[model samples]
Target chain A: MFNFNFSGEFVAFFVFAVMIISGAVLMVSFAKVVHMVVSLAAVFIGVAGMFVLLEAEFLAFVQVLIYAGAVSILMIFGIMMTKHQEADAEQAKPLHETLTAIGALALFGILFYAIRQSDFPEPEQALAQGTDNTMEIGKLLFTQYVIPFELVSVLLTVAFIGAIVLAKKEAE
Target chain B: MLSSYLTMAAILFCIGLYGALVKRNAVIILLSIELMLNAVNLNLVAFSKYGVVPSLTGQMFTLFSIAVAAAEAAVGIAILIALFRARGTVNADEYDEMRR
Candidate 1:
Protein backbone atom coordinates (compact mmCIF):
# COMPACT_ATOMS: atom_id res chain seq x y z
CA MET A 1 0.00 0.00 0.00
CA PHE A 2 1.27 3.44 -0.91
CA ASN A 3 1.58 5.80 2.07
CA PHE A 4 2.30 9.49 1.94
CA ASN A 5 0.55 12.11 4.02
CA PHE A 6 1.24 15.03 1.70
CA SER A 7 0.87 12.65 -1.24
CA GLY A 8 -2.40 11.20 -0.01
CA GLU A 9 -4.41 12.85 -2.75
CA PHE A 10 -2.21 11.44 -5.48
CA VAL A 11 -2.25 8.01 -3.89
CA ALA A 12 -6.03 7.97 -3.68
CA PHE A 13 -6.33 9.22 -7.22
CA PHE A 14 -4.02 6.55 -8.54
CA VAL A 15 -5.87 3.82 -6.71
CA PHE A 16 -9.21 4.97 -8.04
CA ALA A 17 -7.79 5.29 -11.54
CA VAL A 18 -6.56 1.70 -11.47
CA MET A 19 -9.84 0.42 -10.12
CA ILE A 20 -11.80 2.18 -12.84
CA ILE A 21 -9.55 0.97 -15.66
CA SER A 22 -9.55 -2.62 -14.51
CA GLY A 23 -13.28 -2.64 -14.02
CA ALA A 24 -13.84 -1.19 -17.47
CA VAL A 25 -11.57 -3.75 -19.06
CA LEU A 26 -13.32 -6.56 -17.27
CA MET A 27 -16.71 -5.26 -18.30
CA VAL A 28 -15.83 -4.94 -21.98
CA SER A 29 -13.92 -8.19 -22.39
CA PHE A 30 -16.25 -10.42 -20.43
CA ALA A 31 -18.69 -12.35 -22.58
CA LYS A 32 -21.21 -13.24 -19.91
CA VAL A 33 -23.90 -10.71 -19.08
CA VAL A 34 -23.67 -11.58 -15.42
CA HIS A 35 -19.92 -10.97 -15.42
CA MET A 36 -20.40 -7.66 -17.20
CA VAL A 37 -22.90 -6.58 -14.57
CA VAL A 38 -20.39 -7.48 -11.86
CA SER A 39 -17.80 -5.33 -13.56
CA LEU A 40 -20.28 -2.49 -13.78
CA ALA A 41 -20.76 -2.76 -10.02
CA ALA A 42 -17.02 -2.64 -9.51
CA VAL A 43 -16.71 0.46 -11.64
CA PHE A 44 -19.51 2.15 -9.74
CA ILE A 45 -17.86 1.33 -6.44
CA GLY A 46 -14.61 2.76 -7.69
CA VAL A 47 -16.42 5.93 -8.70
CA ALA A 48 -17.92 6.18 -5.25
CA GLY A 49 -14.46 5.91 -3.78
CA MET A 50 -13.33 8.75 -6.01
CA PHE A 51 -16.24 10.84 -4.77
CA VAL A 52 -15.12 10.17 -1.23
CA LEU A 53 -11.64 11.33 -2.12
CA LEU A 54 -13.18 14.50 -3.47
CA GLU A 55 -14.90 14.95 -0.10
CA ALA A 56 -18.36 14.10 -1.35
CA GLU A 57 -19.42 11.42 1.08
CA PHE A 58 -23.14 11.76 0.49
CA LEU A 59 -22.79 11.47 -3.26
CA ALA A 60 -20.55 8.48 -2.81
CA PHE A 61 -23.08 6.75 -0.59
CA VAL A 62 -25.89 7.46 -3.01
CA GLN A 63 -23.83 6.15 -5.92
CA VAL A 64 -23.39 2.85 -4.15
CA LEU A 65 -26.98 2.64 -2.95
CA ILE A 66 -28.66 3.50 -6.23
CA TYR A 67 -26.30 2.21 -8.91
CA ALA A 68 -24.60 -0.83 -7.43
CA GLY A 69 -27.66 -1.93 -5.46
CA ALA A 70 -30.82 -1.11 -7.37
CA VAL A 71 -29.78 -0.53 -10.98
CA SER A 72 -27.51 -3.55 -11.22
CA ILE A 73 -30.19 -5.78 -9.72
CA LEU A 74 -32.65 -4.46 -12.26
CA MET A 75 -30.20 -5.19 -15.08
CA ILE A 76 -29.75 -8.76 -13.92
CA PHE A 77 -33.47 -9.24 -13.74
CA GLY A 78 -33.85 -7.94 -17.29
CA ILE A 79 -31.21 -10.37 -18.50
CA MET A 80 -32.96 -13.28 -16.79
CA MET A 81 -36.40 -12.30 -18.02
CA THR A 82 -35.24 -12.10 -21.63
CA LYS A 83 -33.22 -15.32 -21.63
CA HIS A 84 -31.09 -14.39 -24.67
CA GLN A 85 -27.85 -15.93 -23.47
CA GLU A 86 -27.87 -18.64 -26.09
CA ALA A 87 -28.89 -16.42 -28.98
CA ASP A 88 -26.31 -13.71 -28.25
CA ALA A 89 -23.43 -16.02 -29.02
CA GLU A 90 -24.75 -17.05 -32.40
CA GLN A 91 -25.94 -13.75 -33.87
CA ALA A 92 -22.64 -11.88 -34.15
CA LYS A 93 -22.12 -9.63 -37.16
CA PRO A 94 -19.33 -7.32 -38.36
CA LEU A 95 -21.27 -4.58 -40.04
CA HIS A 96 -20.47 -0.89 -39.26
CA GLU A 97 -17.35 -1.82 -37.36
CA THR A 98 -15.09 0.42 -39.37
CA LEU A 99 -17.47 3.36 -39.27
CA THR A 100 -17.91 3.19 -35.56
CA ALA A 101 -14.19 3.01 -35.02
CA ILE A 102 -13.61 6.09 -37.12
CA GLY A 103 -16.32 7.97 -35.32
CA ALA A 104 -14.96 7.08 -31.91
CA LEU A 105 -11.47 8.07 -32.90
CA ALA A 106 -12.72 11.38 -34.20
CA LEU A 107 -14.56 12.03 -30.99
CA PHE A 108 -11.49 11.20 -28.93
CA GLY A 109 -9.35 13.49 -31.03
CA ILE A 110 -11.75 16.41 -30.59
CA LEU A 111 -11.99 15.87 -26.85
CA PHE A 112 -8.24 15.62 -26.44
CA TYR A 113 -7.69 18.77 -28.44
CA ALA A 114 -10.26 20.67 -26.43
CA ILE A 115 -8.85 19.56 -23.12
CA ARG A 116 -5.31 20.36 -24.18
CA GLN A 117 -6.13 23.78 -25.57
CA SER A 118 -8.31 24.95 -22.72
CA ASP A 119 -6.85 26.97 -19.82
CA PHE A 120 -8.52 25.95 -16.58
CA PRO A 121 -7.97 28.39 -13.73
CA GLU A 122 -6.60 26.98 -10.51
CA PRO A 123 -8.39 27.77 -7.27
CA GLU A 124 -7.25 31.03 -5.72
CA GLN A 125 -8.25 29.69 -2.36
CA ALA A 126 -10.10 26.67 -1.10
CA LEU A 127 -13.76 27.53 -1.19
CA ALA A 128 -15.99 26.53 1.74
CA GLN A 129 -13.44 24.77 3.89
CA GLY A 130 -14.52 22.15 6.43
CA THR A 131 -18.22 22.40 5.62
CA ASP A 132 -20.37 19.29 5.56
CA ASN A 133 -22.05 19.52 2.14
CA THR A 134 -24.78 17.00 2.87
CA MET A 135 -26.75 19.45 4.98
CA GLU A 136 -26.18 22.25 2.53
CA ILE A 137 -27.27 20.05 -0.34
CA GLY A 138 -30.40 19.01 1.52
CA LYS A 139 -31.37 22.61 2.12
CA LEU A 140 -30.70 23.56 -1.49
CA LEU A 141 -32.65 20.61 -2.80
CA PHE A 142 -35.68 21.61 -0.80
CA THR A 143 -35.44 25.40 -1.08
CA GLN A 144 -33.55 26.57 -4.18
CA TYR A 145 -33.95 23.53 -6.41
CA VAL A 146 -37.39 22.47 -5.26
CA ILE A 147 -38.99 22.60 -8.70
CA PRO A 148 -36.36 20.42 -10.36
CA PHE A 149 -36.44 18.12 -7.40
CA GLU A 150 -40.18 17.74 -7.72
CA LEU A 151 -39.79 17.21 -11.45
CA VAL A 152 -37.33 14.42 -10.87
CA SER A 153 -39.81 12.75 -8.55
CA VAL A 154 -42.45 12.97 -11.23
CA LEU A 155 -40.07 11.56 -13.77
CA LEU A 156 -39.26 8.63 -11.55
CA THR A 157 -42.93 7.95 -11.06
CA VAL A 158 -43.57 8.05 -14.79
CA ALA A 159 -40.67 5.74 -15.40
CA PHE A 160 -42.05 3.29 -12.87
CA ILE A 161 -45.43 3.21 -14.57
CA GLY A 162 -43.85 2.93 -17.99
CA ALA A 163 -41.67 0.05 -16.92
CA ILE A 164 -44.66 -1.83 -15.56
CA VAL A 165 -46.63 -1.25 -18.73
CA LEU A 166 -43.77 -2.35 -20.93
CA ALA A 167 -43.13 -5.51 -18.95
CA LYS A 168 -46.70 -6.70 -18.83
CA LYS A 169 -47.55 -9.45 -21.30
CA GLU A 170 -50.42 -8.90 -23.72
CA ALA A 171 -53.37 -11.28 -23.53
CA GLU A 172 -54.09 -13.16 -26.72
CA MET B 1 0.19 12.72 -10.33
CA LEU B 2 -3.13 14.19 -11.37
CA SER B 3 -2.00 13.86 -14.98
CA SER B 4 -1.36 10.19 -14.44
CA TYR B 5 -4.84 9.69 -13.04
CA LEU B 6 -6.36 11.58 -15.96
CA THR B 7 -4.40 9.50 -18.43
CA MET B 8 -5.59 6.30 -16.86
CA ALA B 9 -9.19 7.50 -16.96
CA ALA B 10 -8.84 8.52 -20.60
CA ILE B 11 -7.42 5.15 -21.51
CA LEU B 12 -10.27 3.39 -19.79
CA PHE B 13 -12.75 5.56 -21.58
CA CYS B 14 -11.22 4.76 -24.94
CA ILE B 15 -11.19 1.06 -24.31
CA GLY B 16 -14.79 1.21 -23.24
CA LEU B 17 -15.68 3.17 -26.31
CA TYR B 18 -14.05 0.58 -28.52
CA GLY B 19 -15.89 -2.21 -26.81
CA ALA B 20 -19.21 -0.43 -27.07
CA LEU B 21 -18.76 0.24 -30.75
CA VAL B 22 -17.14 -3.01 -31.92
CA LYS B 23 -18.89 -5.60 -29.78
CA ARG B 24 -22.16 -7.00 -31.00
CA ASN B 25 -23.49 -8.08 -27.65
CA ALA B 26 -25.96 -5.74 -25.97
CA VAL B 27 -24.76 -6.66 -22.50
CA ILE B 28 -21.18 -5.85 -23.35
CA ILE B 29 -22.29 -2.54 -24.77
CA LEU B 30 -24.09 -1.75 -21.55
CA LEU B 31 -20.93 -2.52 -19.59
CA SER B 32 -18.95 -0.25 -21.88
CA ILE B 33 -21.42 2.54 -21.28
CA GLU B 34 -20.91 2.09 -17.54
CA LEU B 35 -17.19 2.37 -18.08
CA MET B 36 -17.63 5.63 -19.92
CA LEU B 37 -19.78 7.02 -17.14
CA ASN B 38 -17.17 6.11 -14.53
CA ALA B 39 -14.53 7.84 -16.59
CA VAL B 40 -16.59 11.04 -16.53
CA ASN B 41 -17.11 10.73 -12.82
CA LEU B 42 -13.37 10.47 -12.30
CA ASN B 43 -12.80 13.57 -14.34
CA LEU B 44 -15.45 15.48 -12.46
CA VAL B 45 -14.02 14.62 -9.07
CA ALA B 46 -10.49 15.32 -10.19
CA PHE B 47 -11.37 18.74 -11.53
CA SER B 48 -13.33 19.55 -8.43
CA LYS B 49 -10.26 18.93 -6.32
CA TYR B 50 -7.76 20.78 -8.51
CA GLY B 51 -9.75 23.34 -10.51
CA VAL B 52 -11.85 26.43 -9.91
CA VAL B 53 -15.42 25.18 -9.49
CA PRO B 54 -16.88 25.02 -5.99
CA SER B 55 -16.48 21.46 -4.68
CA LEU B 56 -20.14 21.14 -3.89
CA THR B 57 -21.21 21.75 -7.48
CA GLY B 58 -19.00 19.01 -8.82
CA GLN B 59 -20.27 16.65 -6.16
CA MET B 60 -23.84 17.63 -6.87
CA PHE B 61 -23.43 17.13 -10.61
CA THR B 62 -21.86 13.78 -9.96
CA LEU B 63 -24.84 12.80 -7.83
CA PHE B 64 -27.22 13.81 -10.58
CA SER B 65 -25.14 11.91 -13.08
CA ILE B 66 -25.41 8.79 -10.95
CA ALA B 67 -29.16 9.18 -10.74
CA VAL B 68 -29.38 9.62 -14.49
CA ALA B 69 -27.15 6.60 -15.01
CA ALA B 70 -29.38 4.44 -12.83
CA ALA B 71 -32.45 5.50 -14.72
CA GLU B 72 -30.69 4.84 -17.98
CA ALA B 73 -29.59 1.37 -16.91
CA ALA B 74 -33.09 0.42 -15.93
CA VAL B 75 -34.57 1.63 -19.20
CA GLY B 76 -31.77 0.18 -21.30
CA ILE B 77 -32.05 -3.27 -19.78
CA ALA B 78 -35.80 -3.22 -20.11
CA ILE B 79 -35.51 -2.31 -23.78
CA LEU B 80 -32.95 -5.04 -24.25
CA ILE B 81 -35.34 -7.51 -22.73
CA ALA B 82 -38.07 -6.45 -25.09
CA LEU B 83 -35.71 -6.73 -28.02
CA PHE B 84 -34.72 -10.23 -26.99
CA ARG B 85 -38.30 -11.34 -26.58
CA ALA B 86 -39.23 -10.20 -30.08
CA ARG B 87 -36.05 -11.18 -31.91
CA GLY B 88 -34.61 -14.00 -29.86
CA THR B 89 -31.16 -12.34 -29.81
CA VAL B 90 -29.26 -9.61 -27.96
CA ASN B 91 -26.71 -8.85 -30.61
CA ALA B 92 -26.62 -5.22 -31.78
CA ASP B 93 -25.81 -6.19 -35.34
CA GLU B 94 -28.92 -8.32 -35.63
CA TYR B 95 -31.08 -5.36 -34.66
CA ASP B 96 -31.30 -4.13 -38.23
CA GLU B 97 -34.90 -4.93 -38.95
CA MET B 98 -35.87 -1.40 -38.06
CA ARG B 99 -33.27 0.24 -40.27
CA ARG B 100 -34.63 2.09 -43.25
Candidate 2:
Protein backbone atom coordinates (compact mmCIF):
# COMPACT_ATOMS: atom_id res chain seq x y z
CA MET A 1 0.00 0.00 0.00
CA PHE A 2 2.95 2.27 0.41
CA ASN A 3 3.49 3.38 -3.19
CA PHE A 4 5.53 6.55 -3.16
CA ASN A 5 8.98 7.95 -3.60
CA PHE A 6 11.35 6.83 -0.87
CA SER A 7 14.00 9.24 0.27
CA GLY A 8 16.01 9.95 3.39
CA GLU A 9 13.88 12.95 4.23
CA PHE A 10 10.64 11.02 3.75
CA VAL A 11 11.88 8.23 6.00
CA ALA A 12 12.84 10.73 8.68
CA PHE A 13 9.48 12.41 8.34
CA PHE A 14 7.76 9.09 8.78
CA VAL A 15 9.67 8.33 11.94
CA PHE A 16 8.94 11.76 13.40
CA ALA A 17 5.29 11.42 12.47
CA VAL A 18 5.06 8.12 14.30
CA MET A 19 6.80 9.60 17.29
CA ILE A 20 4.44 12.57 17.46
CA ILE A 21 1.26 10.57 16.95
CA SER A 22 2.22 7.85 19.40
CA GLY A 23 3.31 10.38 21.98
CA ALA A 24 -0.02 12.17 21.65
CA VAL A 25 -1.93 8.92 22.00
CA LEU A 26 0.06 7.98 25.06
CA MET A 27 -0.49 11.40 26.55
CA VAL A 28 -4.21 10.92 26.18
CA SER A 29 -4.39 7.33 27.42
CA PHE A 30 -1.86 7.31 30.23
CA ALA A 31 -3.35 7.07 33.69
CA LYS A 32 -0.59 8.80 35.58
CA VAL A 33 0.04 12.53 35.32
CA VAL A 34 3.78 11.97 35.21
CA HIS A 35 3.43 9.56 32.32
CA MET A 36 1.28 12.04 30.43
CA VAL A 37 3.87 14.78 30.90
CA VAL A 38 6.59 12.51 29.57
CA SER A 39 4.49 11.69 26.54
CA LEU A 40 3.83 15.36 25.96
CA ALA A 41 7.56 16.04 26.04
CA ALA A 42 8.07 13.36 23.44
CA VAL A 43 5.43 14.93 21.25
CA PHE A 44 7.07 18.33 21.63
CA ILE A 45 10.42 16.94 20.56
CA GLY A 46 8.82 15.29 17.56
CA VAL A 47 7.18 18.56 16.59
CA ALA A 48 10.55 20.26 16.83
CA GLY A 49 11.94 17.69 14.43
CA MET A 50 9.14 18.41 12.01
CA PHE A 51 9.86 22.12 12.27
CA VAL A 52 13.47 21.45 11.40
CA LEU A 53 12.41 19.40 8.40
CA LEU A 54 10.30 22.35 7.29
CA GLU A 55 13.49 24.48 7.43
CA ALA A 56 12.53 26.53 10.42
CA GLU A 57 15.47 25.93 12.72
CA PHE A 58 14.66 28.81 15.04
CA LEU A 59 11.10 27.66 15.55
CA ALA A 60 12.30 24.13 16.17
CA PHE A 61 14.78 25.27 18.78
CA VAL A 62 12.18 27.47 20.43
CA GLN A 63 9.66 24.64 20.37
CA VAL A 64 12.02 22.39 22.28
CA LEU A 65 13.14 25.09 24.70
CA ILE A 66 9.73 26.50 25.55
CA TYR A 67 7.38 23.55 25.18
CA ALA A 68 9.56 20.55 25.99
CA GLY A 69 11.54 22.54 28.51
CA ALA A 70 9.50 25.20 30.29
CA VAL A 71 5.86 24.32 29.73
CA SER A 72 6.14 20.60 30.50
CA ILE A 73 8.23 21.20 33.61
CA LEU A 74 5.63 23.72 34.73
CA MET A 75 2.96 21.06 34.24
CA ILE A 76 4.96 18.57 36.30
CA PHE A 77 5.17 21.09 39.10
CA GLY A 78 1.44 21.57 38.90
CA ILE A 79 0.97 17.83 39.11
CA MET A 80 3.17 17.65 42.15
CA MET A 81 1.27 20.36 43.93
CA THR A 82 -2.10 18.90 43.00
CA LYS A 83 -0.76 15.40 43.86
CA HIS A 84 -3.52 12.87 43.21
CA GLN A 85 -2.12 9.42 42.42
CA GLU A 86 -5.35 7.74 43.45
CA ALA A 87 -7.40 10.02 41.24
CA ASP A 88 -6.45 7.86 38.26
CA ALA A 89 -8.82 5.25 39.66
CA GLU A 90 -11.73 7.50 38.79
CA GLN A 91 -13.32 6.55 35.48
CA ALA A 92 -15.12 8.77 33.01
CA LYS A 93 -18.70 7.96 32.13
CA PRO A 94 -18.76 5.49 29.24
CA LEU A 95 -21.48 7.33 27.38
CA HIS A 96 -19.59 10.61 27.52
CA GLU A 97 -16.36 9.00 26.36
CA THR A 98 -18.17 7.34 23.48
CA LEU A 99 -19.79 10.57 22.43
CA THR A 100 -16.51 12.44 22.50
CA ALA A 101 -14.85 9.72 20.44
CA ILE A 102 -17.59 9.89 17.85
CA GLY A 103 -17.38 13.67 17.70
CA ALA A 104 -13.63 13.63 17.29
CA LEU A 105 -13.86 11.02 14.57
CA ALA A 106 -16.44 13.03 12.71
CA LEU A 107 -14.32 16.14 12.90
CA PHE A 108 -11.26 14.31 11.64
CA GLY A 109 -13.22 12.87 8.75
CA ILE A 110 -14.47 16.30 7.75
CA LEU A 111 -11.02 17.86 7.93
CA PHE A 112 -9.38 15.03 5.99
CA TYR A 113 -12.00 15.25 3.27
CA ALA A 114 -11.47 18.99 2.94
CA ILE A 115 -7.73 18.63 2.85
CA ARG A 116 -7.89 16.03 0.10
CA GLN A 117 -10.25 18.05 -2.05
CA SER A 118 -8.13 21.20 -2.06
CA ASP A 119 -5.48 21.60 -4.76
CA PHE A 120 -2.42 23.34 -3.45
CA PRO A 121 -0.10 24.66 -6.13
CA GLU A 122 3.60 23.98 -5.94
CA PRO A 123 5.29 26.50 -3.65
CA GLU A 124 7.90 29.06 -4.70
CA GLN A 125 11.46 28.01 -5.44
CA ALA A 126 12.76 29.85 -2.40
CA LEU A 127 10.31 28.05 -0.08
CA ALA A 128 10.50 24.63 -1.75
CA GLN A 129 14.29 24.79 -1.56
CA GLY A 130 14.10 24.58 2.23
CA THR A 131 17.02 26.79 3.05
CA ASP A 132 18.24 27.64 6.53
CA ASN A 133 15.82 30.34 7.78
CA THR A 134 17.07 31.34 11.21
CA MET A 135 18.44 34.68 10.06
CA GLU A 136 15.46 35.53 7.90
CA ILE A 137 13.06 34.73 10.72
CA GLY A 138 15.05 36.86 13.15
CA LYS A 139 15.18 39.73 10.70
CA LEU A 140 11.45 39.59 10.10
CA LEU A 141 10.74 39.16 13.80
CA PHE A 142 12.56 42.36 14.67
CA THR A 143 11.32 44.38 11.71
CA GLN A 144 7.96 43.50 10.09
CA TYR A 145 6.73 41.67 13.21
CA VAL A 146 8.02 44.13 15.79
CA ILE A 147 4.67 45.20 17.20
CA PRO A 148 3.38 41.70 17.86
CA PHE A 149 6.80 40.74 19.21
CA GLU A 150 6.70 43.52 21.78
CA LEU A 151 3.09 42.68 22.63
CA VAL A 152 3.94 39.05 23.30
CA SER A 153 6.64 40.13 25.68
CA VAL A 154 4.11 42.27 27.50
CA LEU A 155 1.65 39.39 27.58
CA LEU A 156 4.25 37.12 29.10
CA THR A 157 4.98 39.65 31.79
CA VAL A 158 1.31 40.08 32.59
CA ALA A 159 0.82 36.35 32.67
CA PHE A 160 3.72 36.00 35.06
CA ILE A 161 2.27 38.52 37.42
CA GLY A 162 -1.20 37.03 37.13
CA ALA A 163 0.09 33.57 37.94
CA ILE A 164 1.92 34.86 40.94
CA VAL A 165 -1.17 36.63 42.16
CA LEU A 166 -3.43 33.63 41.64
CA ALA A 167 -1.08 31.07 43.15
CA LYS A 168 0.14 33.21 45.99
CA LYS A 169 -1.05 32.34 49.48
CA GLU A 170 -3.35 34.83 51.14
CA ALA A 171 -1.67 36.81 53.87
CA GLU A 172 -3.76 36.08 56.90
CA MET B 1 3.20 16.54 0.41
CA LEU B 2 1.12 19.43 1.68
CA SER B 3 -1.85 17.14 2.09
CA SER B 4 0.12 14.70 4.19
CA TYR B 5 1.20 17.33 6.70
CA LEU B 6 -2.33 18.69 6.86
CA THR B 7 -3.68 15.21 7.47
CA MET B 8 -1.24 14.61 10.29
CA ALA B 9 -2.22 17.86 11.90
CA ALA B 10 -5.90 17.01 11.58
CA ILE B 11 -5.40 13.65 13.24
CA LEU B 12 -3.43 15.22 16.04
CA PHE B 13 -6.14 17.84 16.49
CA CYS B 14 -8.80 15.17 16.75
CA ILE B 15 -6.84 13.20 19.32
CA GLY B 16 -6.31 16.30 21.40
CA LEU B 17 -9.94 17.26 21.04
CA TYR B 18 -11.08 13.85 22.22
CA GLY B 19 -8.84 14.05 25.25
CA ALA B 20 -9.99 17.54 26.12
CA LEU B 21 -13.60 16.50 25.93
CA VAL B 22 -13.36 13.05 27.50
CA LYS B 23 -10.93 13.72 30.34
CA ARG B 24 -12.35 15.03 33.58
CA ASN B 25 -9.11 16.25 35.09
CA ALA B 26 -8.24 19.91 34.68
CA VAL B 27 -4.54 19.21 34.20
CA ILE B 28 -5.27 16.71 31.42
CA ILE B 29 -7.54 19.26 29.82
CA LEU B 30 -4.68 21.76 29.79
CA LEU B 31 -2.36 19.18 28.26
CA SER B 32 -4.92 18.34 25.59
CA ILE B 33 -5.20 21.99 24.72
CA GLU B 34 -1.42 22.10 24.33
CA LEU B 35 -1.60 19.18 21.95
CA MET B 36 -4.16 21.01 19.87
CA LEU B 37 -1.94 24.08 19.79
CA ASN B 38 0.96 21.95 18.66
CA ALA B 39 -1.15 20.66 15.80
CA VAL B 40 -1.93 24.21 14.81
CA ASN B 41 1.75 25.07 14.80
CA LEU B 42 2.46 22.14 12.51
CA ASN B 43 -0.19 23.32 10.09
CA LEU B 44 1.17 26.85 10.08
CA VAL B 45 4.71 25.70 9.33
CA ALA B 46 3.50 23.32 6.63
CA PHE B 47 1.47 26.05 4.99
CA SER B 48 4.36 28.45 5.15
CA LYS B 49 6.43 25.97 3.22
CA TYR B 50 3.75 25.24 0.61
CA GLY B 51 1.48 28.23 0.45
CA VAL B 52 0.74 30.54 -2.51
CA VAL B 53 3.17 33.25 -1.34
CA PRO B 54 5.38 31.63 1.23
CA SER B 55 7.53 33.67 3.58
CA LEU B 56 8.30 33.91 7.27
CA THR B 57 4.76 35.00 8.06
CA GLY B 58 3.51 31.63 9.19
CA GLN B 59 6.56 30.89 11.29
CA MET B 60 6.36 34.35 12.84
CA PHE B 61 2.76 33.74 13.73
CA THR B 62 3.75 30.40 15.18
CA LEU B 63 6.35 32.09 17.37
CA PHE B 64 3.75 34.42 18.78
CA SER B 65 1.37 31.56 19.30
CA ILE B 66 3.98 29.54 21.19
CA ALA B 67 4.71 32.43 23.49
CA VAL B 68 1.03 32.92 24.16
CA ALA B 69 0.53 29.20 24.68
CA ALA B 70 3.30 29.07 27.25
CA ALA B 71 1.67 31.97 29.03
CA GLU B 72 -1.69 30.25 28.84
CA ALA B 73 -0.34 27.06 30.35
CA ALA B 74 1.32 28.95 33.15
CA VAL B 75 -1.84 30.86 33.99
CA GLY B 76 -4.04 27.79 33.59
CA ILE B 77 -1.84 25.75 35.90
CA ALA B 78 -1.80 28.61 38.36
CA ILE B 79 -5.57 28.73 38.31
CA LEU B 80 -5.71 24.97 38.69
CA ILE B 81 -3.51 25.20 41.75
CA ALA B 82 -5.75 27.85 43.22
CA LEU B 83 -8.79 25.71 42.59
CA PHE B 84 -7.14 22.62 44.00
CA ARG B 85 -6.27 24.54 47.12
CA ALA B 86 -9.73 26.00 47.53
CA ARG B 87 -11.85 22.97 46.56
CA GLY B 88 -9.49 20.15 47.57
CA THR B 89 -9.83 18.53 44.12
CA VAL B 90 -8.77 19.03 40.49
CA ASN B 91 -11.77 17.35 38.92
CA ALA B 92 -13.50 19.41 36.26
CA ASP B 93 -16.93 17.99 37.02
CA GLU B 94 -16.49 18.89 40.67
CA TYR B 95 -15.77 22.55 39.93
CA ASP B 96 -19.36 23.67 40.28
CA GLU B 97 -18.78 26.01 43.16
CA MET B 98 -20.01 28.86 40.99
CA ARG B 99 -23.43 27.23 40.94
CA ARG B 100 -23.59 27.79 44.68
Instruction: Give the winner by DockQ.
Output: 2
- DockQ-based class of model 1: acceptable
TM-score for each model: 0.84, 0.95
User: How do the residues A49-139 of candidate 2 rate in per-residue lDDT, one tens digit apiece?
Assistant: 9998888889999999999999999998988899575547656588888898999999999998898787787765556333548878877
Estimate, for each residue in A1-172, the C-alpha lDDT of model 1 and write its tens digit: 1123557777787787678778877776676778877887888788788778767778788888887888778877876776556434634444566676677777777766666566666676774746776897787677877787777777777766766666566566
Top-scoring candidate (TM-score): 2
Query: Residue B4 in model 2: shift from native, Å?
Result: 0.8
Local distance difference test values of all predictions, in order: 0.71, 0.88
Interface RMSD of each: 4.1, 2.1
Q: Enumerate residue pairs that collide in model 2.
A: none
| Candidate 1 clash pair list | none
DockQ of each: 0.46, 0.71
Q: Which is the leading candidate under lDDT?
A: 2
